[model samples]
Target chain A: MKIIAVCGMGIGTSVLLKMNAEKVLRQLGIDATVDATSVAIARESRDAQIILTTPDLVDQLQGLPSEIVPIEHFFDLEEITAKLSASLL
Target chain B: MASPKQLSNYPALAKAFADNSIRVGAIALDREHAIEMAGELLVASGRSTPEYTQSMLDAVAENGPYIVIAPGIALAHGRPSEAVLEIGLSLVTLAEPVVFGSEANDPVRLVLGLCATDHNSHIDIMAELATVLGDAESVNTVLNAVDSDQIRLLF
Candidate 1:
């Protein structure tokens, strides 16, 4: 599975999201590749099966083929676990 | 399962904060001022040039307040640029929370400024940070820290 973790600049928070998501995926025994990118780039990623991002950026990414998962708290693993499990597992 | 304590989990981040990069109970008039204060610490630490500070502010202007990563925290940063000299971090805890215009996560009390010369250099530090910030109990401890020394002890 391919996933994209997106933030505005793609350097800071998205990287955090990507790393934590990878950790969660590993713990859950799910296999997936997560990429961190800017919203502009994420909009163009047609192959992404899931896109994890903050709740606010969800509107801008409207109509993308990937499942847009709105992450309210980027740092919270429990939240990430529940959200990702609901969507992926 | 219980969340692991943040003790000694972020050695690099602890060292970065030890280099006079942390300010506790600071006052900032607005979100911009808060971000500038965090960036200034990075500049003082020689991790980035003064221009990098403006780049961070510009990033907020262009991208909105997505930096407000959690309910009461903002991780201020811009892309790696010529202005960045090395990988570093600066932390500022505010006397009064400042709103960054995010409805979900507004009135940020903690601002963490990060600058890296490359994409991969700061990833580990950020990962450590994610763990530290993820737990509300840990976040509360940091938020209520009396001094920089107290904050340093957690890492």
Candidate 2:
């Protein structure tokens, strides 16, 4: 599965999330490709199956093909993994 | 500039983000100017100049809202050289909603301005700020703050 961690800059928190997601996927024995991108670029990145971001930017994503996961705390790796797992199907 | 502990206070937070070179304030204006305002504050803090401010704003404008960094807070910043002489912070509160390209679960209220001299240093500060913002109570306290001194005590 492919996941894209989206945020304002796509450099700091998004990169952190991508690393945690990779670790989580490894622990779950699921092979996944996790990438980080800014919200603007994310809108056009069709390669991603899921987009993770905070709640405030949720509304801005209106017609994207990827499913959106709103993360309240970017540091909550477990929560992020859980949400990603449930959305994988 | 103030220490991270002192930055916990509102006034200190404001002043910490400020320097003789940077101008910070609470502005009740249109949301479109959010980036502009943030840039001005950074410049006034003596971190950058108008050219740099404009570049940072342009980066965000091209990339969408880089403002929504925290839960309810937006940290508007760009490449260090876009407009930064040194690392600095600035704060601005909006009276109303400003569309900052966030998901439905989070809305932005407070804007923390960042002017970093380099990527590594910026990341360090960003990590620290993220840790502080992850605490719900602390963030709530900052949101509820009325005065700068009150903000200091909370930190």
Candidate 3:
């Protein structure tokens, strides 16, 4: 599966989100490639199975085929674990 | 605290804290005030122009409070541009929590300001920072830190 972590600027929190998601995915034994991208580029990733981002950015990703997951706290591994599990597992 | 191996791999983080860019138990009147303090730290460290501070506020105004990336922390930054003279990070732990209009991460007590000359230069710094902030124990230490020395020891 393919996952994308997004923020206004791809270089900041999005990268952090991508790392955390990769950790959670690994712990869950889920095989997926997670990429961190900007708001503009994430919209073009049509093949992404899940898009993890802040709640405010969720509407910006609407109409995409991917499951747009609204992440409340990027540092919360339990939250990320539960969200990804419900969506992917 | 980050592991010794982790800090060894990301020496820039240790350098940043050693430079005294961290303010512990600061008082911020509101969310914007918290972000402004973070920006001021970057400017005080000579990492970015004074104008970079306003740009961070503007980004939050335009993009909302997504910078509140964790339950009690907000990382303030704007796009890479001329305002940034170099890559830097500044951290401030508020004496009183302030709301940033984030549903999940409201009342942020820690504000981290970041400035980079370009997109890729700070990737390692961000990764190191993520490792430090990702742990709840470390987050607690950050929130309760009484001085910058205590924070520096975390890395």
List TM-score (chain A only) for every prediction.
Answer: 0.97, 0.87, 0.96
Candidate 3's residue-wise lDDT over B63-121, tens digit each?
Answer: 78888898888989988899998888999999988989998888899999998787677
Candidate 3 lDDT tens digits, A1-89 = 78999988787889889989988999999889888888889887799989999997898889999999988888789999999999987
CAPRI grade, predicted model 2: incorrect
User: What tens digits encode model 2's per-residue C-alpha lDDT throughout B1-155?
Assistant: 76766554343234345534222235535444766777787777687778777766666676555456545666666765645677777666665546666553245677766766654545445545655566687777667666655454543
Identify the superior model by DockQ, candidate 2 or candidate 3: 3
DockQ of 1: 0.65
Off by over 4 Å in 1: B1-7
Q: For residue B24, give model 3's deviation from the true position in Å.
A: 1.7
**Best first by lDDT, ranked:** 1, 3, 2
Candidate 1 lDDT, A1-89, residue by residue in tens: 89999988788999999989999999999999898999889887799999999877888788999999988778778899999999987
Give fnat of each prediction, in order.
0.67, 0.15, 0.72
Candidate 2 Cα outliers beyond 4 Å, as residue runs: A1-81, A87-89, B1-25, B101-107, B153-155
Error of 1 at B100 (Å): 0.8
The interface RMSD value for candidate 1 stands at 1.2
Clashing pairs in 1: none
Task: Compose the digit string of candidate 1's lDDT tens values, residues B52-126.
Answer: 999999988987888888898999998899999888889999999898998889989999999977767777788
Shift of residue A69 alpha carbon in model 2, Å? 6.0
